[model samples]
Target: MSFRHLPSRALIASVLATVMVSFALRGQDLREADAQAMSQEAYEALQRGNAALAVREYRQLLEAHPEMVAARANLATALVSLGRFDEAIAQYQMALKEEPDNSSLRFNLALACFRKGDYLQAAQRFGTIHNGEPNNVRIATLLANCELHLRQVAQAIALLKPLEKSHPNNLDLEWILGMALIRAAHPREGLERVQKVADRGYKAEAYELAAVVYMGLTDFDKARSDAEAAIRIDPHASNAYLTLAMLDGYSGDENGAAEEYEKALKANPQNLQARTQLGIIFYNQRKLDDARQQFNEALALNPRSLLTLYELARVERAQEHLGTAVKDLESCVHEDPQWLPPHIELAALYYILKRPQEGAKEKAIVQRLMAEKQQHGPEPSVTGSLPPSP
Candidate 1:
């Protein structure tokens, strides 16, 4: 129902006219004393780390006083503490309508979106907030983080570069900016910052990043050393394990690579790259079912990943799901016309499906892409290596 339709609810107030009331009295249609006591109890629940109890109390309080913005914001915080991020986001959003300029509500909403992996949404909100408060290091750092997660390397670099100049010795800013620099293909500069952060005790993450920088520089020995150091500092360093796996795979030690990949997944089951790489291993081993499972899991983590989509399409085709494979391959082609691997796969599929015309069209695209590649020579890999040569 439209909120304007509820005049009775809107007009219901404990005091006939009071603009300078207590925080609790702002929205609840309750006597001042009762509102104070109830809100105080809810606040205490939050302070005591009893979010479930706070949620219950806040729900009861909001029931009789649906317009209570303060109470609703507190309720949203409680929901976030209890890992109910979606519920928390809803409450924050509703409260924002009542007080559109509430920074706390907007911050919490962005935080909830970030925690829920909606980095794009979180980035937009954080960007606005950061623009308004240029000196707010926390907000700027978080916005940079969101950019990194979204693969907007240039944006992240722009946000962090100025911060690095202003706060030269801050390890947090240095490490993050280092990562952005590396992604922006300035590995030599990136490595210097990462080394400083590592020397300053952010060993695990910095070492992991240094390993990647070394890989890009083709210093395999240094890459192995840094990766091993990262793992020693934190056994649960899944990315460290992933780096070691890549090293082994590149060295032609398939068994060692598989073991490292397994360890990486065990440390972090949600590591999408680890899952996808292991799936490729299974594919090379001719274990179609296992490869399919891993590809599907990676897709769940990032449904729009053309790499995963193409991998899954190959598995589907091998399993004789030609129609499904065709759809996925076509989607990949539409999403990235210049990408050659999917075109090659689609050409083979079209031929198998007895569509000579479509196959010839795909072949033509592949030929054009190859010509462009030859003219351009080969672009350097951004992070260590390219996708496994289709």
Candidate 2:
């Protein structure tokens, strides 16, 4: 060929070099050995959090030794660090199959299950681990969360009772156990337990939780006192103010509730719960425009707030805006069909609107939910006599 028309030798040489390199790397025993060594190196690297390097090594090792449990477990942990929970779960499964009783593997598996939103499976695995090491705080916390999600309040409380003995001074353990007790319908006992912490001067937050517990127990005087104590300690505690407002509302002091909600707003201008409570207070006091204003303000803060939606529906109903009320109530029902108050209010609103059949159906739903709640016990009376206004 003429030199001018000849192929570029450099191009041909580059392709040939790439082909030879590919062939040399393809299935060579030395290459496989090197990969295994690198995987081991990656496992060590993971201890130092070099996730990128570890991923490459472990992936190569897995290609050759697919059944290696140590490699698989390390890979799973590395996958977790890489935010690959699904892949981590698959790897953890393989490790668990190899060593069925590996607690660490099970613990990781449980966490992975939780991250995947497979809470039931996570709860079961956590329960098993808890049974083996009953005093493990992490597992207990996981178990409690699962129980709460599943609404197995009694089981959660029972699971936590033993933890109280071992972790007597653990603040979180006590708080969780107190909440579990309250959920299990022992609000009086729960408040007492929480008050013990508050009395010990832990923080104003304990007093706040204690106030909520007392409210649940219908011990309004104590609830008010505890809530006030929280406010006195930390004027910025919005929860304490919100709790006091609700307690006042339940005790038929709409004006007092409104004032407490105002204080709550001063502490946290964006407190949607307080705003919604203020709306409810206004609604109860027949201040229709003010109620609507508060609800609108709350909705502006959080368009998706369930309480605000429900209160807006209530305010609409009271204003005789039947269609708008129906729409708002429908939204609330869609958001939280399990909350008794909304269903009851919806049924009442429908009846008032002359939709007797729809009202009856809603009333039936309320009755069903009430029956279920009754199985727990007579509802604790959050309503109690308020001390004459100071």
Candidate 3:
């Protein structure tokens, strides 16, 4: 009921109404006071560069005033600053629950998801925000990025094409679309387009993308050069070092790769990719125990990483733990059947162990796949042989 229409009918009603009005007024004053104090605390924390403390205060404010949108938004921002991605996502989701139609909240949630590697969810969330704000460059760029990670390269291309046209000569869009094209299997066209952008002083990101494309195309020297250029552009770019390590590994320079990976880890201690790459380098160098340790460490950080599991299984096989290797391989295959390398390794292991029946079954699968490849005629070479399962 409207406050103006609230009845003051009887003696008890009048007393209750007065008490209720006083209580409501006092509650409003208390909320205002609390909000002011929290805001001041947040500002002070920020000025002191104590992001973690700011996050705590903002979180407290949010807890006490669930409907305070400003507190909630600032809390999400603080969570990001603290690298608390999951917490930030939760807070953004809570904010969205209260304001479901808020595009900004949705965008923030998408960004949090992206940081946490939930690209598919991020892509979907960004797509919703894009629908609401079609011309938002940041949202569009993020959606394109999410599409690329989700391997929907064609969708990324489609999303960026019009944006590029509307804002002609936008280097960021051009280079992004170029990478999407390359990932989508149009390397020649993609490289040519990206080269144009690279020449226009959009060098660092463009070179990094070029490095990845060169790696995909098996042009190791070119990959190394571009990766080096990326490093020159940003001395502390962990990605450039890690990618260079991959190039070294692929080119059979174990020691060089190890050194590059060390630099990568030095630059970013949380570089799981670098750690995994280092593990594989050690594995290839016949350091089974070291490889296993690295894989274990990486798995501790990301339990669901099938690559780490596969690597551990491979290391176990190398150490002659056939049963353990098989168990891990089984888990890997069960989790992700489309990963062809694990299947090939599993089949090869069965063969090596003289389990002819099991070997025959796996052989049949590979042979069938090979037959299909032959039927298609002139299939592309599968690069980089996987280590045999011990």
Angstrom error of the Cα, residue 226, model 3: value is 1.5
User: Top model by lDDT, which number?
Assistant: 1
RMSD (Cα, Å) for all candidates, in order, is 11.2, 11.0, 9.1
Compared with the true structure, what per-residue lDDT tens digits does model 1 show for residues 1-390? Answer: 577766574456644344546644654545656777888999999999999999999998898678899999999999999889999999999999999999999999999999888999999999899989987777888888888888887888888887777788777777767777877768798799988887687588788878877877878898899889989999998888888998999899988998999999999998888889899999989899999999999999989988988999999998999999999999999999999999999999999999999999999999999999999999766544411100
Give stretches of model 2 more than 4 Å off: 1-85, 115-117, 131-145, 170-173, 196-206, 217-238, 247-275, 282-290, 293-314, 317-380, 383-390
Q: Which residue pairs show backbone clashes in model 2?
A: none
- Residue range with the least summed lDDT across 10 consecutive positions in model 2: 381-390
List, residue by residue over 1-390, the lDDT tens digit for candidate 2: 569876699988999999998888774867667766777698789988898788888888888778778888888888888888889999999899989988889999998887777778889989889889877886897788788667777777777787777777776666666766766667677766778778776568888877776776667798889988998899998888888888777777878888888998999889887888788778877899998999999999999988788888878877789789888888888888888888888898888889999999999999999999988886645432221100
- lDDT, model 1, position 106: 90
Location of the lowest summed lDDT over 10 successive residues in candidate 1: 381-390
Model 3 scores what on Cα lDDT? 0.80
Give the RMSD in angstroms, all C-alphas superposed, for model 3: 9.1
Question: Alpha carbon lDDT of residue 116, candidate 2?
Answer: 73
- Compared with the true structure, all predictions reach lDDT values of 0.86, 0.81, 0.80
Model 3, runs deviating above 4 Å: 1-139, 146-152, 168-172, 192-206, 249-255, 265-288, 291-318, 329-356, 359-370, 377-390
